[model samples]
Target: MNHGQTAPEDRARPLSVVLAGGGTAGHISPMIAIADAVRRSRPDARITMVGTPSGMETRLVPAAGYALETIDRVPMPRRLSADLAKLPGRFSRAVRQAAEIIRAAEADVVVGVGGYVCTPMYAAARRLRVPIVIHEANARPGLANRVGRALGGSVAVAFASTPLGGADHVGMPMRREISQLDRAGRRAEARAALGADPQERLIVVTGGSSGAASINRAVAEFASSGRAAEAGVRLIHITGRGKEVLDPAGSPLSAPGYAQRDYVDGMETAYAAADLLVARSGAGTVSELAATGTPAVLVPLPHGNGEQALNAHDLVSAGGAILVPDDEFTADFLAQTVAPLARDEDRLAEMSRAALTSGVRDADEQMAARVIAAAEAGRGEGRSRA
Candidate 1:
């Protein structure tokens, strides 16, 4: 609870929440969704974000209208090359800075998502006696979240298949915009808002929030070739603010049948507009696609033991979507895979059902309520003013 603020339920106290984690949208998006959920239940809950300056969260968190406190930190390299000499010093500074940030937030609870920076971030919160919670988005635990669980209230997760070691499954926190799609008879209007053509199969492409260079390259190549245009597909591509150019002016895919934006403002409408979706298999994307029942072709990031591949395979094995490895991606393959699927109304319908089956629609509310319960339960104590 924040100083002298009372909870509406009992007029007793108001809670403050501190979220620690984010390097990618996969990590940061969930935190934002959870914060929104927390706000809905307890409007008085104050929220702040703590993140390493090295990642996109530094830009994204502030962009979402939240203040970001920066700490100098990086994740441990997966391989131990000789350059690890900087680890100890950097880790020490990050912990100290993170601890200071916690003290400043006057936070009642600290939530850790993903990323190596989480180690020091949660360490500060734990040592400061703030209630801690971890939200794990993957079906499998990341090494950081696995270790951080000891310091958490419960491991909130997106997928039912995730291994959380007896932790409660609070589902993935989806952006509130997605839950709006649950309203009756909004699909066609939502689709029209994104400017879908009445005669063509609407296809939306995203390379994750920061943009997938490989996916972007592939889509740009495909879009430039006029193949998508020939196939009568309307395209909406999110560039994630990395590249300035999407295609040449005279390119075949550069026609009025397409709209390209660096950042997506109406993601819900994009989902509503898309019949066949092409995207990265980030947990947040996977959950969003599932919730919106949008059929997708998932291209997992090929590096790092196939984390994204594993996620895509989970959906594929359950008949939700197709998994195309990055190495297998090309302009021709993308056109052949996406174009036909877009035209096949029955396939789109089936895939949408499969995707819906994979969704945890109420994840945000479940996670928020759980975290708030813990925060309330732990609120008998207060932070030391020292």
Candidate 2:
């Protein structure tokens, strides 16, 4: 009955797409966006997600209304340890599990978005002679994606500066909400919905779904010091789930313009309401900020392969974002640097322009097209083999 459903003629042929990625929102969100795009273009397409059982993908993929097949996590060890000793067996088992899932799905093509589960999935897809497409979110390619590239998969990178071989700069595939958001047109409504004053400049601070301790502490300290209010900017701070709650009642700076929440379900509203942002430079966060033309002060997470720092480089260099080292993102820095930046309307407007110039609004569609082409090519190859 749905008008979007495939017509009778188109019902006979449907492509089976298997998307592999997980562990983090950076990987999973893009995967879902691409999948959504594929469904929009081909209503009869059968799409499934492959992820680790314990990762965030378990919830996110299913919540996005896609069937998810999960395998055990098999992280590649860097040094000789007990886990390294078990790597051979664990990896073999994971690959076998992945291969079985691929076979069951009868995947026309396998697409990887780069996460812990991708290594096994990539190996399995190769073994099955299935065409593989990879999307790397970070400027620095992860180990799984690097391995996938070595396996000769079609590669797409979010940043032009990503050093992956044979990579096409397709940009990060964003959620439909973000990709289609009309920030300028909807700003008033969005702010009103959030109970934020439409006339006041707003600064939104976030640290993904798991919250960053240092960011929270620094922002809280700045707010408590009354500098944020003095700067003539309202604040919307989203401390990640299960993190320490910042109490406004305890602070003299708890003005009507300041609001805090543990999580924001409608991120589009948050993006629309914000003139500036202060947050960790995760690949997803950076991409979204750029796409929305929301100027940012990015604090790269100190751990990992330093990929967060790399992720923020292009935007920072474009004058759309400012990258601050984790150690330097203190309360004093917020007071001295961020507070002044928020008050400068001319600079914020220029940064917003730069952010839009650095972003790609149609990346979801672009990635979907690539995935569909690979699927068609794979199906043609299958027929030829038969």
Candidate 3:
């Protein structure tokens, strides 16, 4: 039960880790990336993921080749209501379920990437006296990560200015496809993969895993307007599953210079191929754009705690991207601003350079290192208590 060993051979067994996060691609993607990093560094390490049964993680975690454990979701109510009254009972049950999962996994460290599943995971890890490592992907910390931090979890943030105290700026952990992409070198191939002519100015639009209605309306209208075709711009629109745009005839949308997809599996190709990306400014999207040096027109999700806007601040301030409010990001803006900007090679190149200047491409490894260290420290503390 020695806790302070640097080498694997000094320990009785390989490290056992449990990662908790889900509900969206933002949380799950980073969690998976960190797990991959940890596995690469320590192939013998055992990794398990904990998420709510109904979260995207059920499909994503298994698809990523990790073991997954599910617990009932217990979202904290924001206001004084019936749901708020039931919170304690739900939270307690979830915590008990989480504790069983952690104990069964024999987790050395519990890593969380803020989501609905994390609060209970944090509570469970604390109860087990296991070290908790948290990755806060938003500039405005979520309630779960805030609670984890207050419980003395080692906190890391995607944004340097995140409000969490004593948090390290680790950027966002992303899949290697994006993090290691040489955008300039792979541009032609990536464009080809997306069926875009190498010379065509490509604008890639996405509202993340779940499509944004405002963005869909604006972009779809712009696409149907035929301006993009007239200007020789090619567009790839990922409308999210079941959120497809429709025409006035009440049929699926079809427009010149527009390729609509319900989803795209590997976004790195899109990042590489896109001359300009039009997307919501989630922390993950912002980090990917910066990492890949992709110029962008960011439309923050109009709702939420204003975090999406804050997430885009650094890149926008650095001249890597343009931020448009949801209300203002209209088809007119696309035609007037984004379409013209897409054709401006000089401006796009300059923006790409600015993006690269602020990019951090090694966050997965950085977070993995933090998790490993926390695991060792936790083990040492266990030895001391024993």
Candidate 4:
């Protein structure tokens, strides 16, 4: 199907699209999903993504067969430290560099998917009079997108009801891999791959890559304390890089029966194995949690204005998950607070149903339509203005 401007007059053809921003899979994965949607909707639309040389996007983008243009733009400092000292000079140089990339790409529009690197790019796009838009994945805004949104012509958000009520509400986009799973199939797979105990409940603890020290400590303590076992729950922990009591090897817990790993690439399997998921409430994590229809206990990173907490709050309020304050996210509190839910099958089912109900299954495709529509509308507005 050919993508076109949804205007009353002539419906114009699709235009070239450029997606800029990446660091985490939260950012990179959504951008990629959006690109894929654009390609399917408008076959003639050429797409490119801007990524740093070292970020995961560098490998992910090329592997997906999309050309990546690298730019050396550093993130602006959030706190008043020595790093903040370089802001003025660094931003000045970044603006010029990003402007050059926009000119060379001859892009129709630039979209920033939250990150520090997008600062210079968006700044330059503003200066050059190019149409700019951005997608803020967090319930709380980031250092970059807060500034970028102030200057952008349009803004889209994951959780619309948050404090950032001004930007347009476009739900969180998810990768197709996570989107394809149905609850029945994933449950069976999760049971098999993780060796979940049928008589005992299962709790899956994952702290993304590099691991959350607090989450690891709390989960380990719970497993060791026998509280986890008392709940008739076996723990399956995904430690990004954190070392458990069994530090040398990545092993699941054995004291009360735990299965641990440094990392888990097969997320579909992990989600299926979990009766409850405990982890950081990152945008990607939230999207995947909703996609799989699994109940979660989210602890937002207590740093940086506590954006992760805000993200979690949005989901929790919707009845999909629970938000635990990172500082108070102790093993004692967890075993005491969360363990009770395991026995309450009714609440668990309610959470599972809520998680599935609120999910935006076709977020990528929906967002692609918005972006393409924006570009076409911008062109129309320009013509009218002229």
Candidate 5:
């Protein structure tokens, strides 16, 4: 044997972790946050991510400086259809692809944040004897995460009411910027960065990454009403990609004290700059609001499984946020509710404190520790088998 050669038994394997989640920022953001946490704690850890080939992860995971593997988008049908007839073959192929990735990575543990790829990844991990850990970001668990939980994994949830049995009630994992933000200290800087008037209270409105047409229309109408300007408020409207409101002249809409952007790269600065927020109550948004103590007027999406309403319920009840029905979130609602709320310094401060009380800033570190522990346990099991 070569002098440089070492026995396999003497070589220590670095921790191998495979994370799966994608499609929406809600899933992918937390997945990446947790991955960052794991790396901070275990620098030698080899981390890989899995997502559907068509999901947002194709762009985001690579941008976050992590290796990503893709599989087919195997959506389980809620109702029988032609797609359902083709599900078996598609799912089988995806599972095989997932298993191959896991084997090639020598993944000691699989952590799924909930998405289309998660069901197959969970199944493959189970078949491969790799330990699984799950983080469910919504109050109502999704089908894939529910399946993962049933298949027996350590489960964590952003909300205590998530109904994933035995799930540890860990809050949502957020990127370092949002998690560590000192809103008060950075308020002036953040406002300056966004080009807001330092003396005026700023309201940041976002419809999440994909944008919301109704919210955009309502904000444009509110801008035309001039109520926000009259109240000495400034507005940063994140209209989402391709969803900008336009005037009769086909130019983007404009009003005094109103600024519009299709997107903001770092939402933490937006959260810091806002005295008030108007946005949908996606799990990620709610958690970030609470974390940064940015009080919000939340408009839940009218469609979907009604999880958005459920996601905002606790924060609204906590007096940290307000919830309005989608159809009722009109210009008048903004003038009467959000604009006035923005101008009320004392009330805004109270809501900010309440939001902070409801937030969890350490979930990323907490989830990372849990994931690493699961991986270590799997390593123990493998050594025992050997």
Candidate 6:
């Protein structure tokens, strides 16, 4: 296997690859990045994404120009209950649907980025003897990827501390726009684009696509407290769609140096204009910040098995970011921590340098290469079976 490059004998044969993962941007984004990488390496490759009808992948996958195949979502129940009782039957049905998709796509390989859909996809791929590659985007392994690892699939992880067995640290695959961002060069234009004062320092606050209510409320209260303006710091707050809208009337966030939007279609510009980030430490968000060399104050989500805190650990230890609990990330905390950080130019720059030290700019290419190798191996296995 020549890694990312298609094998000489296989060059004439168009590759068919099936990508599985969805339900959230964290899983879907990496899958899209790898899909783009695969398309760049093999323009003729037939890439099909498997997701549930209700997932964000339904829209995101089609928009990314890949064929999407839907499967029933079968969420695994953690405790003994009625849902647990229904698990086996739902899982079996989902696996059957996924197996049909794999066969129909003539998938040479199945790549899974952990989500509810991944469990069935992984099981189906294994049953069909298809090569499987799993990407775990969280620091702690999720249930689907954990099972994928146990099935002897090739595993890749965003963070080194991920507990998945046989995992290789491949870093998080970033979107093309973020990976190619030139923050220094685009700072002026980006600031202008977002209606920010050119000289004012900017802090970006976000909580993924759906937004974090706690982060939003904290920032809003901080804005109302008048500390951000006193420090001459601007804020760009992205409150996810359908969330409580920050009333611009009588709110400091509506003032000259502050801006609030429900969603930012162009995060690259927002990242370029930012001097600091105040957000949740989801795997994708953490990777993007590291890759962009942006300093941050990460408030991991309060729920969900403590994975978010683990995700932000290395960056915090490296001095690239500060980790605070969701409950502790209040207006006072922002006034004390974020205010000082924004005002201290030298400290912010140092943190930026530290962030870049741990970032992987070529993760998309690396993971794409791994997927290509797995596909080639699966083809060889199929031929041998024949």
TM-score of every candidate: 0.83, 0.92, 0.93, 0.85, 0.95, 0.92
Worst 10 residues of 2 by lDDT: 1-10
Q: Which residue ranges in model 5 land beyond 4 Å of their true spot?
A: 1-11, 383-386
How accurate locally is residue 34 in candidate 1, as Cα lDDT from 0 to 100?
Answer: 85
Model 5 clash number: 0
Best by lDDT: 3
lDDT of 5 by residue, 227-320 (tens): 7788678889999998888987899888888989998979988998898999999999999888888999999999989999989977888899
For residues 220-259, what per-residue lDDT tens digits would candidate 1 score against the true structure?
7777667777877877777788554344564333544566
Q: Write the per-residue lDDT of candidate 3 for residues 259-307, one digit (tens) a residue.
A: 8888887899889889999999999999999998999999998886899
Which candidate order results from sorting by TM-score in descending order?
A: 5, 3, 6, 2, 4, 1
Minimum summed lDDT over a 10-residue window in model 1 is located at 244-253
Off by over 4 Å in 6: 1-12, 244-257, 383-386
Q: Native-vs-model 2 lDDT?
A: 0.86
lDDT of 6 by residue, 1-386 (tens): 43345445555678889999999989999999999999899888889999999999999888888878999999867688999988889999999999999888878889999889999999988888888999999998888989887887899999877777778998999887897788899899988887777788888888877889898888888886677787678888888887644565733346445678877777788788888888889899888888888889999989978989999988888889999999999989878889889879999999999998988788899989999988877776543211
Which structure is stronger by lDDT: 1 or 6? Answer: 6
lDDT of 6 at 342: 85
Error of 6 at 290 (Å): 0.3
Candidate 1, 61: how far from true, in Å?
2.4
- Candidate 5 or 3, higher lDDT: 3
Give the Cα lDDT of each candidate: 0.75, 0.86, 0.90, 0.76, 0.89, 0.85
Each candidate: how many clashes? Answer: 3, 0, 0, 4, 0, 0
Off by over 4 Å in 2: 1-12, 247-257, 383-386
Residue 150 alpha-carbon offset, candidate 4, angstroms:
3.0
